[model samples]
Target: MKLHNISFNNLRRRKTKMAFLTIGLVVGIATIVTLVTLTNSMSSDIGRKMDEFGANILITPQQNGLSMNYGGISLGGVNFDQKEIRESDLALISTIRNSRNISAVAPKVVGAVEVDRHQVLLVGVQFDKELKLKQWWNVFGKAPERGDELLLGSEAARVLNVMSGDTIDIKGEKFKVSGILDQTGSQDDSLIFSQLPVAQRLLHKEGRLSFVEVAALCSGCPIGDMVLQIAEKLPAAKVSAIQQVVEGRLKTLDQFRRFSYAMAGVVVFIGSLIVFVTMMGSVNERTTEIGVFRAIGFRKSHIMRIILLEAAVVGVLAGVLGYAAGMGGAKLALPMMAEGKQVQLVWDGVVAAGSLGLSVVLALLGSLYPALHASKLDPTEALRAL
Candidate 1:
């Protein structure tokens, strides 16, 4: 009999066993697919959040008395005098030789202000410069044109029960609401933006900026090193990068990714064992059939090929079905997993092909040992057991 015919007949005869083995493999493949998908999605999500923050490098006054301990040892905090960046420092940055990607620079002076019963963050920003930051802000009216005009974040607008053309009292000074930025689910969505001079005046801060938001021209540049270089040049002002903060969070997430990978490995290992045992059991139950094949002059090599072919067919079929099911499962579960955060899954053809390829390889590995054992069976011993 042809190897193909023998394999097909064996699979049909042991339908229940094949079905169980396939289910085990499908579970493992689905798990692996979900983890990989989530890992990629999270990386993209973190990058998007960083982009919304606008500034690649953030400059802030170093906080006092922060310390850390390692190996049961404590290290004292490095203290530096608090100094604000001047307009001269901004100009100096513009002149740096390798700072070509320094696109837009804006200084922010943040403070607290009371509007009726509401306490809000008062942000003094350069209106013209902030436009180059990003597309985070969509003004409902016009951008701030003068000291009297202010833009509120969407949440802030809803809280204050005010909109465009309305005036809100901040620290007893009335300012016209010129615009309201669309919500981006960040710190910006809770603050008020006004001309820097206006904010400084309202907050009683003169010629002093709390921090400078510097938008870099290059997206994938090494921002931490750039921040360090900037800090070295402007010894008076401290520098912080948005990428640094995002990377710190990503490090923590890396631990979770490792855990997910380990879990997937465990699940796949168990699934492979189940497939091996199931195939072995099917071989034992079909000993009489094997004897009949040997009687019909089937070569040992042909029997081996039949067993392996059955395994390969089962593996491929399960892999395709598992991939389809995994994709569908991810689509349905992504939003729920994100906990109301806006997320997007970008499907790459390469990733999909790789995932399916991995599934096939795993399936074949799972069936190899069982297929070998079945191929080595003695027809005389198999018939005697039957």
Candidate 2:
């Protein structure tokens, strides 16, 4: 009979012990897989949601003003001509080194316009990018479609005494109110929104933007690096990143990842220890059998192979069961853990294969010392136990 067959028959005779060893390793592998899968899914979900909370980087016109005391009276020094960014030049942002980290770039043309002869801030925006950037804005009605259509901020609508579906005049041209925004308690609350091209034409500042808002945060890229890169690309525009939201999310994720690593480490250690103890016991029980094989001319390497082969078989079984259990655990645990947010699990085939391989390797390492001790047994002493 082949050595492998002998190993297989030995395992068949020791079902109870094999089952215990497989169970211990499976539990460990399952916990590890669950933690890793959950961490990966959480990172993606958090990153996407954080990206939606609006632009962390503000690109606005660089102000050039001087303040000084003149003739015993404090008077501000004359300011240079107002600088505006050209809409055409916005594409240069995509050439930055960390440009891929930028999620959205929403340009705006800020100008003062009259609504029923009362002056208010007029903000022109590309609805596609603006809508994505300001996802927190809850509009009661639809976003503007036509050039003549516009959305009113909550405070603006209140001040103008108008609601959605009302008509108002901007820059001597009639505009239909398509939507009214919910109260946001920000400067946006007092601003009126219109399509970029239409507002530019109305304000007579075609292709000139007051500022741009950029959303830039991803898995592990530094926001500061992105800001520097944007500044390099657009030297004339002031680029600054707002860190409140991004920093908070990053801090939370970091803590979560650390906890996962700690727990996984503890579980893996316990699993390896269990495998070692079980293999050691198996070696002791088979002492007389080993002695008989040695007397019958079995080589030390052959004895070692039989012990390792048994461990490898158990490892294979544990790995398969562990993966299945981990996936199931993640699916069940995520809802409770994440507070009802839907988390789509991203399958990592590499991790799955690695877990399988790791299980086999762990089994081999755990059984090695026991197998070696069995190989060095004195036949005369071992046969006495028989």
Candidate 3:
């Protein structure tokens, strides 16, 4: 019979032993696949949440300033020739090469207004954009949707002694308190928010913007390139990335990826060890069989081929089964791992191909020594055990 025929017959006769070897390989491959798939899903989910966290880019009017401090003494400098960033100029941001990375753009106009003889920072914002940009805001009431409505911060509401549905006067304009934000421990807690057009008119700075907040942190997004592009597009505006925020989000996602790879590496090593030990034991048990083949005019190469062919078949079988099992495990584990976050399972052809190839390579490498030992066995010596 041919070498492959002999290999197939041996596998059929030793079904239990082969089954154990296959199981070992399958477990290892499955563990690796599950980790990789789960990591990718979790990373995607976290990326979406990070995008909702807040803006990582800030754009403001450009101004020239001079430092007057000397000998570390307290001194104030003058800012001159300040340039305003037109509300219309914000459209140039959408023309950037990486503009698709931009998530939300919130432009604001700011000015101080008096309420009950107390000066309060009043901010004009596009509520639709602001609500989308600040997803974490838990307003006690509702967002302001009308120019005659206002959203007050927790501290601002407390100072003004107002709640939802209360009316307050600003610059001779009466606005109803639409909502009071929950305490966020930020500067926002002391500010009053109103519709963009209303605030612009109230501040008498129509068609002008104080600053813009851009949510542009996405997977593999080039924050630096975007900043430069925005600066180029709006020459009178200062565009900058919030480095700490960008680095923190990137580092978090990277940590998850690195951790999955590290775990996969450990499982691979154990898998290799399992294959080596099992194949070596099988070779020892088949010494007499190998001797018979040698005595029957079968060459050393033929004996080696029979042993390796068996491993190759097992590898192929294990690869298919392992990939299926791994994907299932990832699906089941996602909910618990993601803590209720919705994650879509990915069926990657590349990952499937990779797993198959890895299994085959590991099997061949692990069985190499045993195949060599079997081929080198002295026919007479091996036959004596029979």
Q: What TM-scores do the predictions have? A: 0.68, 0.87, 0.82
Q: Report the lDDT tens digits of candidate 3 across residue range 70-142.
A: 8998599999999998999989999999999998999999999999999999999999999889998999889
C-alpha positional error of residue 128 in candidate 2 after TM-score superposition, expressed in Å: 2.3
Q: Rate the local accuracy (lDDT) of all candidates.
A: 0.77, 0.87, 0.91
lDDT, candidate 2, equals 0.87
Quote model 2's TM-score: 0.87
TM-score of candidate 1 versus the correct structure, residues matched by position: 0.68
Model 3 gets an lDDT of 0.91
- Candidate 1 lDDT, 1-386, residue by residue in tens: 56798789878987888898888878877777777777667667766665555777787765555577889898756655556666556676765555876767888899999887989999998888888686567778889898999999988999998999999987778899998888878888899998898888888787888888887735355676677778877888778766656566677668768977898889778877877788778777777877777767877777777777887788787777777777777777778755345888756566577666766676667667766776677878777865
CA-only RMSD, every prediction: 7.6, 3.2, 3.8
Clashes of each: 1, 0, 0
Clash list (residue pairs), candidate 3:
none
lDDT per residue, candidate 2, 1-386, as tens digits? 79999999999999999999999999988898888888877788877777766788899887788778978898868778656688987999999888878888999998898778789999899998898888888999999989899999898999999999999987678999999999998998898999999888888889899889998766676888888988888878899988887688678878888998999889878888999999999999999999999999999998999999999999998998998888888878777666346667757897688678878888998999999999999988999986
The TM-score leader among the candidates is 2
Select the stronger candidate by TM-score from 1 and 2.
2
